[model samples]
Target: MYIEVGQYLGQDGVWLKNDETRLFIQAFGGMTPEFSRKMRSQTRDYWLNAHWMPHFKAPFSGRMDNDDPEQRAYWQVELLRQAAGTFPCAPAFGPGTDNIPTHGDTANNVWSLASARLVDSGGESYAKAVWHLAGEFELLKYQKTDYLRQGDSSHYMVMTVENNHDDAVPINMAWHTTLGSPFVERGCWLLDNCQQYQVCPQGTEFDTTASLELGARFESLSDIPTRTGGKSDLSLMPGYNGHADFISGVSSSRQLLWSACYNPYYNLVYVSVIPLAQLEDQVSPSFMNYWIHSGGREMMPWADYDGGCDRNYALGLECAIGGSCKGYEWSRENPQLLNKPTYFELAGNSTASFVCINSFFSPEGYGRPITGESQLTEMIEQHIRSLDISFDGLQAR
Candidate 1:
């Protein structure tokens, strides 16, 4: 077990050890176990057990019996058989559904409050280093905020990685999170303020297209001002309606944030974030990042979810910044072969920001209708400026 206290952020968090084992995050006041075993088991079975058949494995199994339906059917059956238990199946995995590889061999760093105690949740109480990559990149800085009206409760987990080599580097990153018991059940409701959707290749199974406009289109719009205070079961918007994929810019910039939110009072979970890229299209070694909030007496504010889960009395707000180990360079040079990597280079080092706030209810109760994009963008920019000012103040301290 490793205990790390991010004093500058004014909060504490934890982390668990091992690249292929369990991880528990307490910064957001939630605990979850890693399901890599199941992920790996399914991935391995897909590759070795499926026997690609007519597709062939080259030197080992060269296109055996091209016209054999028995062989093709066998391959199809094997694919479906393996998919029975695999997650993110078609919409998230695409043609590589059964054979999709794990994001990395393991999970990456998840940002939260002051100190994250990476520990063993299985009663071991082991404390591990929250920044296992500390040797590679020092905690350049940490920032905290109480944007959710939780009275110093909300937190923003930020870590800046500088190029140690004194030279420019390319990287791709994604925030992969696993939530424990009590996940969102099927037929539950979800809501999003995204005016547009960016369909990733992987999400094509759910909905092949994407959009960029949002407005008043809820099956039941309430005047509630927060998620916790609002009614359950919201409707999908006209067009761009599906699960496992969300409005692209939701967690980044001012467009969108948190991938999903839950009405714990009603036991109804809502996932509003989706994969922005596909497994086959993803560039190697990208970094996934987002935010998290928990331990509140009522509904929590919105958080990001580039990866990870919002679960177990907690919400995991993940965002994919870039990659580690100069992997983004690989993506940059091979843009045609890579997934939808953010064009950070477009704005250079100007510092871009994305914000997701999970309120107990929408702003409708405040006498404001769901103005979607216009209101969302305004709020995001405000928060970003506030954080910048806060960071400036922290430096003075």
Candidate 2:
């Protein structure tokens, strides 16, 4: 395995690779350093007077006053756009009505790389990278380590948070794993062990044509009830529908929790897994949050009057401790949001850690939904065996 340090957008990040697969992990925000530098170097009045300012909708609209708090908050959050790949959302995770940015401060700030190395153990080679970041409140410390075995497609991650304050602090964390085109397109299917799902009403403003009723609960994603008295097939991705939606689900089976996105057209599948038995301190994720952004936001960056861009086409399969991406406060206030606890508290001067495994596979034929633990394991083993054969052929040549 090889580890390369670089920047994705403007945030510090790293890439892990072997013979068949390559994975990129970056700090939360998406803007390039140069872009961020330019924005920060300019005066606030410059952006206020700029044409782009008018494209922002309500709450941010008609607020020409430089002293307006809403306008200031909007500008601050805009700088944090473009967070890509797999990143951690900590302390607070999700979209809230509050002024905070989506996914909280951790997702908006840059993280520093602490170390990267390769280790050989038990006749296997593993590559690891450690990253560290401080909370905005400076009350907690966060560390995330990524591990990938040589010639393997699976990427393993462990994230830990330590409370520095003498008093316990509430924490909400999630692994925001995202996939974009050409890996994500129409006909891609989302398969999971989730037994029930609830529609989240937080980001409805991004799409005017959203049909799914807020707070609605359903069993299967293929036949979710919509406001139009119709059932939308969420199993497959929709084409240029100009609608965005958020849904949260829980797995009734406590053995292994997993979700997968399979693109039949490409015969490729991406799976995220968490073994319930391996979790400690009862910090197991309570739900899975799936976000479908199919060219829904017609705002600036996403769209402009002059040949706007298609800033959609991404799916987020997040394993979260919270019910939805809504902030901790909101989840606490509305305990009914989910039957399980929305957030967990980390004891003072103590630490809690979570583990997750994400794997990719390219089968020889059409791919199908991953339904159980044994199937997923066999698929991964098959992929590894194929890699070994290919490597042997190359050496023989």
Candidate 3:
């Protein structure tokens, strides 16, 4: 039952045949322009063209950087590095060049797949697999119980790094997802738990404030927890709420169901030679634990698209082993800058997980955050099972 979802980068992104039974659903090429409007209507349950994203080159458009004939092509091509430009709804996991890899073959540079499966000696599907682009990126692969409901009974998705590159290069990354129209055109909102956030201006003239809002530096899982004041940080819970109220969407106002982003382990080295470096202490890998970072589970509003919907029709759930932004890197020689984010070589045997859960709810009762490590993990697994059952019902048709 494979179908054509949409197009991307002049290519095609097709929906897989067994997507209903697969852990995840991924489209290839670029997200089509018609996706936004279609998603709002219940006349159709699933949308092959359910998402859309603007080209990343818009930020550098008509600038002197585009003046040079060679540079123009470079920027044009490198722009795809931002996953948002290609897939309207996609997450940036792991690490590597924030700007698309201008040095590599831009055609194959983007590898956004829904889910992967590994086979055993008998060639039977053994364990499910998710994508981890390049060695620089590091994300945990887990299931999204609360957000999407479709596809498989073991329905799950976790952003992780595949470490498929040979070069050692600096990298910056985050999940970039542009929900389909009606969601974007009508505008969506966000609710996040992070306490501190910086307006990331990627050299764009457009008022980014309208497009994004960040949370303050968070200290723990709950709204209140042991504040992290010392060098060492503890792995806290993951969750957040939308500020003010839910954003209105075209069809119905939506809210974050459940979200979690945690990296339990990290590989780091704080260089001491750099006198003015902020991270003068030893770069203990423990600090990079997903449970320790500021933004765990969050609910945010997107004032950028359509008008301004607080429901967060489209959301970008992110988790990283290292700081995505440069200034936050505690170590002078930030390990996240490397193409190979860690030496773990997350091949067939490494164990890591990145989980984001979103459940739709009425404006009345708000969602809660998950704190205890064991408890949160268990809850997520249960939600994954629930989603599987729901998807099965849809597939029975």
Displacement of the residue 307 alpha carbon in candidate 1, Å: 25
lDDT of each: 0.26, 0.63, 0.27
Higher-lDDT candidate among 1 and 3? 3
Q: How many clashes in each structure?
A: 71, 4, 64
Q: Give TM per candidate.
A: 0.35, 0.77, 0.38
Tens digits of per-residue lDDT, candidate 1, 1-397, equal 2233432112233333332222223232121221111112424631111001111111221233537775554333222211110111000111211222222211212334433433333232323222222212212221222111111112222223333343333333333332322332232233333332221322222232212111112222222122234332222212112222222223232323443333322332223232222122222212222111121111111112223222112223334443211223333543431233542332223221222222122222235443454454344333333332222222211
**CA RMSD, predictions in order:** 16.8, 10.5, 14.5
Worst 10 residues of 2 by lDDT: 45-54
| Candidate 3 off by > 4 Å | 1-9, 17-50, 55-75, 85-155, 158-174, 185-187, 192-315, 327-385, 388-397
| Top-TM-score structure, candidate number | 2
Candidate 2 local lDDT, residue 131: 76
With candidate 2 superimposed using the best TM-score fit, by how many Å does residue 227's alpha carbon deviate from the native? 0.9
In the predicted model 2, the residue pairs found to clash are 10-31, 30-82, 94-325, 95-325
